[model samples]
Target: MVTDKEGYAQLIQYLTEHLGLFENAGSGVDGSTVMELFEDLLAAQIIVVCGQNPELSFSQRNTIIREVDAIMYDLEEILAGCGRQQVNREQSYFITEFTGLVKNLFDHEIAQLVR
Candidate 1:
């Protein structure tokens, strides 16, 4: 991934801090709910900010997917350690699916940043 570990950490931390992991006390991180929103927003931001780069390649786009995967994996581990029952739900599916979608979109948008 083009982004470094520090960048990934910051992004996950921001998600955890702002969106939070729990809907109520002792409920644990609602992985499905929180991650869906996080992934969507993150993908949208990447498309907006870095989409202007015309030289981006397929491999470069894949790198973004891999990087996001790494970050989310790290977060999932942390949440698991916190005693949260990890769920394979919509958010997880979205993460996997969205990563590929972003890469495909990048192929088109690489020539120019489009909304």
Candidate 2:
């Protein structure tokens, strides 16, 4: 019963696929995009676990926290890495859109958990 919107399935796909980043960066997608995608998926998964089994593994809980922190760190890195005026302008917009998706997904899960 996964929603086809900006929900868990899409977030999981992003983590596995690491979209919005290099397509063929070799091996696997880099950390910034991977972490960003992981964060959203972890958050959604945590909320689900907390609902179904609040006594999730301690390691799993820690993983959720770490993934969320990684997202913030990666966002800062992505913002700072955009060098050159023209590239910086475009990247800044892209970062905003990327972050907005993450924020909306997290907020939606929080709302679902609350209800």
Candidate 3:
């Protein structure tokens, strides 16, 4: 979210480019609800990044991270393929990088209190 549309676009384009190698990329992209969840996470990103909600517990925050991690892992599993596809998997780690991006977005003050 901090990187804005350009950042998100760049990541999406990277993903789509690699996914171009997939025999059934479109179905994979469209059939899953994970993409929609990513959109939801992006929408909620501001809250987590800014530490906007005092009521959000550490467990809750970690749970959010775990959910995102699971989604990314599932995506990576779905993407597993031919030897050449390994390059794409490596390149698309940006999918999980979303978690790092979210974590990094936390304010310095907020991050210390997170754990």
Best by TM-score: 1
Q: Write the per-residue lDDT of candidate 2 for residues 48-114, one digit (tens) a residue.
A: 5446546555664564466556655544454333211122233334444555566565555545544
TM-score (C-alpha) between model 1 and the true structure: 0.45
User: Once superposed on the true structure, which residue ranges of model 3 sit more than 4 Å away at CA?
Assistant: 1-54, 82-115
Ten consecutive residues with minimal summed lDDT in candidate 3? 82-91
Tens digits of per-residue lDDT for model 1, 1-115: 3234353445445545633333232422355344454455557656754565646667766766676576556655544433243333433443444445444444444444333
lDDT of 3 at 114: 53
TM-score to native of every candidate shown: 0.45, 0.36, 0.32
Give candidate 2 misplaced runs (Cα > 4 Å).
1-65, 72-87
Provide the lowest-lDDT 10-residue window in model 1: 19-28
Model 2 CA lDDT for position 26:
31
lDDT per residue for candidate 3 within 35-65, as digits (tens), equals 4434455446645553665766777567555
Candidate 3 collision pairs? none
Give the runs in model 1 whose Cα sits over 4 Å from its true position: 2-4, 10-32, 80-115
- A best-first ranking of the candidates according to their lDDT comes to 1, 3, 2
